[model samples]
Target: MLRHQMTIVSETLMPADTAPSAAAVRSRVTVPLRFPDGYTATAEVLTFHGLADGKEHLLLALGAWEQALLDPEKLDPALPDAGPLVRLHSECLTGDVFGSQRCDCGPQLREAVEKISATGGFLLYLRQEGRGIGLYSKLDAYALQDTGLDTYEANVALGHGEDERDYTAAAQMLGALGATTVRLLTNNPDKAAQLTALGIGVTEQVPTEVHLSPANHAYLAAKRDHTAHTLDLAQPAVPSHDEMLARVDALIPRLRERAEETERIRRIPESTMEDLREAGVFRVLSPKAVGGFGMGVETYVEVVRRLGRGCPSTAWTVGHLIEHVWMLARWPRKVQDEVFADGAEPLAAATGAPVGQATKVPGGYSISGRWTFASGVMHSEWVLLAVQHGDVRLQCLVPISDVELLDVWHTAGLRGTGSNDVRAEELFVPAYRTLDWALLGAADNPGSRIHPDPIIHTPMATLLNLVAPAAALGAAEHAVEMFRERVLVRRVKNTLEDRQADSPLAQARFSHAYGLVATARLQWEEAIRVVTASYQRRPMTMTDHERAAYRLSLGLSGTASAEAVRVIMAGSGGSAHRLSNPLQRIQRDVDVLLNHPTLTLDPILEQAGRGLLGLGITVPSF
Candidate 1:
């Protein structure tokens, strides 16, 4: 279904003789309507005079619908002051009366009545049977439908327009009832569009529940594909892309205020973690099967980048935590069920480079190793450790209680990451909880088959490339903003200029800084393009060339973004480096981000050079 945040259509002229007034309302009679499902309501059935379509259209006002009418001066209600909820339901006899399962019309009508009754509104039952093709033609169309033609195509085959129902009567009925504005309950855009076009003020278009059935799956699918209905037939629905970003953007101020405390304590505060949870930051990339948004890597990158502007440490920790949800999705189905049982959204932190050892046991393996730099481990309930079991390298999922933390995370930057070392001494890991490290590149892995989202097939190398760079880019962007602000106030001590903003050097530095930030974002977008394009086509394991492309583009994004921060730091006055200033923290955080094993310059450069020269890549994880 099509959703617009707000759609305001200009009111137009109607036939002067038939325009709504006291005469538009002909009569009203009280009636009690009940359904076989035990739902009951008292409705005031009303007849209208001079409607465009002379057919006997009836309007049933339920609940406090009469009390909701305004004084004709108020066009819209604000916030909690909601306008009447209305439904323009065209006549459907087969489904609504005979309980046919071939279409969702019956359930939709039931839902609309209940919802409208609860919110106080009128149900305008227009006599446009079979989408205005009449009952006989509708039955003929149904015959065509039995031959595999969809709802719309069957109508066309029967020599009728696809959908002939019009909403002129609906708008007229609302006008007669003094409901100029309404919260429309519908999944059909046509109702909203026609009503708007006919001078009805639609304050909001609220979608009705999707009444799907195994018998009518194809019918719903046709309606969704052909007419663009808002139906998530594949998986559970997630918020729209813009809505998700808005949720993250809304948290920026809070994150910025807490950045100091986060770094001072060397970990994210509990309150801050709750804020992230409320913002849905940690589930941005988790599997939809387990109640996650199941978003793609591109969305994940953009989310990480935006989060960094609030606080680099918070963004870094949250970014890893979000990616771990994606990592957990790649595990076997049994492990996924165990971890996500009882509606628990698991927060996991993983470390793989400093490999551990796993000895094969009866049903699993005994793993032992000290993995360093487990970012966000302090908040995580599970730790994914990379271990060598015999000749095969495996990723073992262990509970946080199975490990001992070594507080050795003192660093030059990103101090809030709390990337301490975790030692797991001779701990038993079930076979179901372990996956072969080599399968990280497989497109048809266990998770891919289990989760409908294709991002579950993303390679670890590709994710590693995107994760840190996204946060680095966000910090660099903040650096440029802070530098621009400082350039306005800082005056040259020895020079005659009143402010540094008047100096040619300041202008040059700001211009260069802005250009570097733009370049870094463009570079990062290239890696995103590569990752998103492949996922759309089909999830495929990245070839060496693809990894090299990602390595160069994303690696350069981090490097370029770091240079942007460096330029900002150099141009910013001495006072800018103080602990109180966020600019210095941003620089230090980005510096440590560049030192990540994946973002390090030497391997990235070598991988790019090899790909350019048509040589094999030496670094498999590049």
Candidate 2:
């Protein structure tokens, strides 16, 4: 059914103008193709003419591919089978041909061929190399990347759009082949959006497996952050920790820039929330079954710590929201299913002060309360509100729609957290959606039984206490860095020393601050190791002494972190104390964050002293 086009590039092999008035497609050749890895697929390679690009683009129709176009034009996703699972794979010369580890392009190509062959579809290989920026420019961008710029940043640095792809030709080719509706096999949202915009019906967006390697981690992260790509680096997929860190690292610069804006708005802006969601920050504690990363407690602390270096308010809110996922997991499986039916998604905030009261009903509880510190509520889909039910406290999970959000948070430090008041009036929460406070922190909780992942078995009470200190640690680190940079350039005002870098006092301050950061880091790591090690054991155990010790770690770390920031700020001179200076902000944030009960040194030391004397912990409920 192939036809010839009238347009000729050079001299026509057989001029369509002279002989044939035919279709745009001139050839459909079946070829048996084998790869070096012994993977084989019979490809019906196709060629088309009069393409808008005037390039010889390729199309390979895979297994039962004929059956795909054989169907009626419309796609019924509810049907047992629906496809032409098509992938409009853009060309990548270095990745596809030379086995470049810099990007996931090669793996994606190999995966697409095998997957499409199994289910039936077409792989349209468009010759838009480097995301339509050509090969030479892509390599040039790689050169820029060596200088520490991200892929997108490098592209912009090189006077090009972050992604210059245009899928108009892809749509035309699909239309020419009569594929009106297709299940798009792509991770890139732009691909689907562009195709849809160009009159092709995208029936479903089927995500691609994250083909993450050490070298391509940042490459994949850039795609996720710049464009909304569906890359869930869940377990057995990619090494989750490194991938998650890479994503967070990509966000730091942006977060630092938005620190002032975050404070001004008294909340994390909606865009920042999207950035966090895109970065997969909120999925660290959700179950893998629901498309979550299901990362461990130590990983959680590390992420929060990194986030603090950017914006402590954001870090504080995100930390609380992340912990809520674990809390959700502790509920009954039926409830967990309802909460996660969509996906392991963003911003589930919880306020745990028993400010709300719940009355036991026949099948549920009628709850009412004005809860404080409902962090991240602006971005939350669900809110876990702690309510007193008779003698015990119950965590009642309610949809965010049920609660009335009150914007009342005004503070000197961590102002962007928007830890506002949220009120629920006579809301009915089903019993299944509730978990007793006693069970939540227990190592042998329902989440452990329901989902036997080691993380599920974590003693969440301690984990909750420790999250704030991570932010403090990170802010302290940020302060150290900021002070270091300032020291090199700052002039010692009214002094003979040319710069602060030359002053002995400045040098001593820098050294002292650096040592405190190290101390804070050591303590944070030591404290968090307890969390990581707890999950690994079958029946995770932390004696009252151990719990006391954990608190001591947090207290010590928080103190060191706060002290580090103060030392840096003091030595940074009068300019450093200004409202405009980030150093002062860091000092304020670090100091305020350390005031949390878990980090307050007096009680922590007292508890540790008791533990050392074989005196039991005051709060030994877990």
Candidate 3:
């Protein structure tokens, strides 16, 4: 049974003679938190002052967490204090703050808050989005999860390991919380080791288990297996791939329709986009330098996978837009100061296809040409028009006012993307505002010269390539949701057979699709994790490029999404083929996503295969 009381399992332990050191870290680095719709929050690091080599370090008064932010020592002045309840809860903007049903993190956080409030404990909520992988990868994972891989396996399939989180900073925060000993509220054992290694005493473990919803039971299992969490489960019997495909084949038509509806509306009416936004979807690519929530590339991949489960367009737009912001964030402070002189609402777009030109002027260059396939153009305050200048390709940021948007994004899929063409007539862009395209792709971007890190300058190609996979995964996830709703009441064809939901075949397909999403998500996250780690340590290297390639391989889950669509749609039969069927629309969306230049099968294969073979890859392929 789960206990609600504060039961002490061990005596308090504080390292004696370990006084707080005089070394001060300027914790007041200002991080500008950017929100969707362009709202900004100034995050001032209230604390970073600390001492001691691990054991009993202190960083008092961090972010204003639920008005729950308070100095731990102030709560209890007793010498060396009994310590606050140091909770290293991962950032789950949607569930914890907004209460989404997709996962248990939100509920668990609420429970922890209630417990901590009543019992006087400290909660250190790290800004680690999507388990430190990032939003894009998480969304991709969601798509894989829809395909039936367990959570751990899904991350792996997506090129990630089981878990990618660091607790050292969390430990520092704990010390700042005036916590010498803590009863951690967690199921993962790794948290315990991390804290202990950091020289903090984890006296007891407070188990915070969430009841599994039908939608997330497999997810829980994956966490237990892959992340080494303390959750227990009995593996179900494995079924053949043929049976799995047959099951999903039946539901495609309805899924296709639902996907189309989501895109046509520009917003998912059934689900709240606000919820996703709060989940840190829009901040995945934020740079650590600014006040934006910084997430590694691979983790972002997983974030997008999860969002994809709810709405593809939201995932796509958020993922693509954030990556663009990340690129801008790397610009020299002077450059950022100049461009952002008007504020951060500059609308920017990219046409992956090389097709524009610029002439060098005295102080800058005049750019003119028409570029298509620019996502988020409808809402951009700045535009990144790629143009050929002399011998090099450059990405010039032109004010939205200087560019004209052409509504040319008429298609049968991803309709809500609002991707249109941007036409400019000899617009003068300052030299500093222009990023050499070749340099940008070579991981030698001008922003990198300013920020000087591989993570910042890695080619836009590597990052942008993930958009289609996430979109496809999202389309497939809609199919799963639709199937779940209809399976119980709908009956399978044949001579008086069981309800479709009751069929073993249905269960198998649903479960399998779940795994695929999970696997894809894992792979995507792993890729970002590798990149982020490298960023935090030394600058990025060829290893980072390999990680990017791995991300591409996992993002190829569009293929799996397509397969899932085919199976689910076929299972629904001819009635689903009608244009009115949601499944048909999902199919069309998947088809469109597959054909997207980024998700183009041949290129992805070539890039990934070349990397695996240890061959040199082109500048932007990663």
The candidate that achieves the highest lDDT relative to the unseen native structure: 1
> Could you give candidate 2's per-residue lDDT for residues 10-99 as a string of tens digits?
123322333222225658899997865579999989887666777778889898875665552333335333548999898998988987
Highest TM-score scorer: 2
The residue-by-residue lDDT of candidate 3 on 161-268, one tens digit each, is 667777766655554433546667788799998888766777777777654543466677677766677775432222233333233333333333445565666434
- Residue 559, candidate 3: how far off, in angstroms? 0.9
Clash list (residue pairs), candidate 2:
none
Return the lDDT, model 2, position 293: 71
Error of 2 at 539 (Å): 1.6
lDDT of each: 0.80, 0.80, 0.61
TM-scores for the candidates: 0.64, 0.68, 0.54
Which parts of model 1 are misplaced by more than 4 Å? Answer: 1-236
Q: Which TM-score value belongs to model 1?
A: 0.64
Worst 10 residues of 2 by lDDT: 2-11
Cα shift from native, residue 73, model 3 (Å):
24
Give the CA lDDT, 0 to 100, for residue 532 in model 1. Answer: 74
lDDT of 1 by residue, 1-622 (tens): 0001111111233434434332266788999988866799889898977777788999998877755543212432353335588888888899889878788888888888888777678888889989899999999988998898998999999889999987777777777655667778888888888777666667788988877644567788888999987777663468777888998898888888988888998999897887777667777888877767888776788889999998889889998888887888887889888887633258888998599999989999998888999998999989999999778988989989889989999988889989999998889998888899888546767888798876787666667667788999999988888787777987779888898889998899899989999999998898888777666665455656766787788889999999999888888878778999898899899999999876788878887889867798876666
